[model samples]
Target: MNHDKEPAKTGTKAGARGLPVLESETLFQGRNEIVIRHQGAEYRMKITRQGKLILNK
Candidate 1:
């Protein structure tokens, strides 16, 4: 089930670096691939059938 309806929490644990922790389930939202745009460049991030993450430019 998608948990995006509720706000996802970041690093709230003690001694944590305070960086955001994003769950793949929410980002992908039941999809296998997603595109991220940064600095005018596009990157594709997808979950392989083996359940590993692969990023391509």
Candidate 2:
């Protein structure tokens, strides 16, 4: 009988594939809204009063 547990991942590669990691605290910068541009398109990300995130295109 073998009882072995795999060690947890703690490296940058642990995140989702091909997705760049950014800290919300740094991105938000104490503001509720931030603009993001992708593929020549502009989008807005906002934090609601309830502390939830909302994205608008």
Candidate 3:
């Protein structure tokens, strides 16, 4: 459970509308690809050689 209210220290920044900004570098860490599971569905996110992000189902 996360109880922190501040987004600055959580690898996210608070936007003007209070929305959290997630950093891709923080999400990816050292990997170029990551898997996201949502609502029993699997998704793949990858960084291309040109450093572009692509998401696939």
Candidate 4:
């Protein structure tokens, strides 16, 4: 569990201030989607049934 800071607007752990903008460093080659870090854990999400992005931690 992540016991660090508040959740970022991106619904992911935007990391500390002054950090790089790119959240996910490792991306699956030939794939556009990349894993993201939320709160403190890692997760990958797909478009929701409502056409919205849903992240499952």
Candidate 5:
């Protein structure tokens, strides 16, 4: 007599992974600050926020 709802399903593939997707634009070069997207990861860095700025070779 107990037929209220169906059974639930459980699985890892049934869910989605929300990755951080970001876009950035560098404004000042002398100030030493930049923002870039690496692979599926995103990050923002500055002279003070992230760490000391280093120019890529």
Candidate 6:
């Protein structure tokens, strides 16, 4: 079995399909929920108990 881990990219650049890539650990900052404000609207991002991410408006 392979146990190698890929290096984390910390550069500011677009990832796959020209989309921006960000690290979740950095975004969450040890929290399970975060609020994102876009165009005067607020959205919530949370990690479920099963380790799945969910975004709600």
Identify the leading candidate in terms of TM-score.
Answer: 1
Which one wins on lDDT? 1
For candidate 2, give the lDDT: 0.74
State the lDDT at 2 in candidate 4: 42
**Model 6 global lDDT (CA atoms, 0 to 1):** 0.79
Better of 2 and 6 by lDDT: 6
Rank all candidate structures by their TM-score, best first, as comma-separated numbers. 1, 3, 6, 2, 4, 5
lDDT (Cα, tens digit) per residue for candidate 5, span 1-57: 125644333334423665433322223435556555677565665665665554431
lDDT of 2 at 32: 90
Q: How many backbone clashes does candidate 3 have?
A: 0
Tell me which residue pairs clash in candidate 5.
none
Report the candidate with higher TM-score, 1 versus 3: 1
Q: List the residue pairs that clash in candidate 2.
A: none
TM-scores, all candidates, are 0.72, 0.63, 0.69, 0.29, 0.27, 0.68
In model 1, how large is the Cα lDDT of residue 57?
Answer: 99
Instruction: Give the CA lDDT, 0 to 100, for residue 43 in model 3.
Output: 95
Q: Please, what are the lDDT tens digits per residue for candidate 6 over residues 1-57? A: 123645444546675666656788867778999998999999999999998999999
Tens-digit per-residue lDDT, 1-56, candidate 4: 24474433233444676443433222333344446787788887655446455666
Error of 6 at 45 (Å): 0.3
**In order, what lDDT does every prediction score?**
0.81, 0.74, 0.78, 0.50, 0.46, 0.79
**Residue by residue across 7-57, what tens digits does model 2's lDDT show?**
322335435685545667767768999888999999999999999999999
Stretches off by above 4 angstroms in model 6 are 1-16
Better of 1 and 6 by lDDT: 1
**Model 1 / residue 36 / CA error / Å:** 0.3
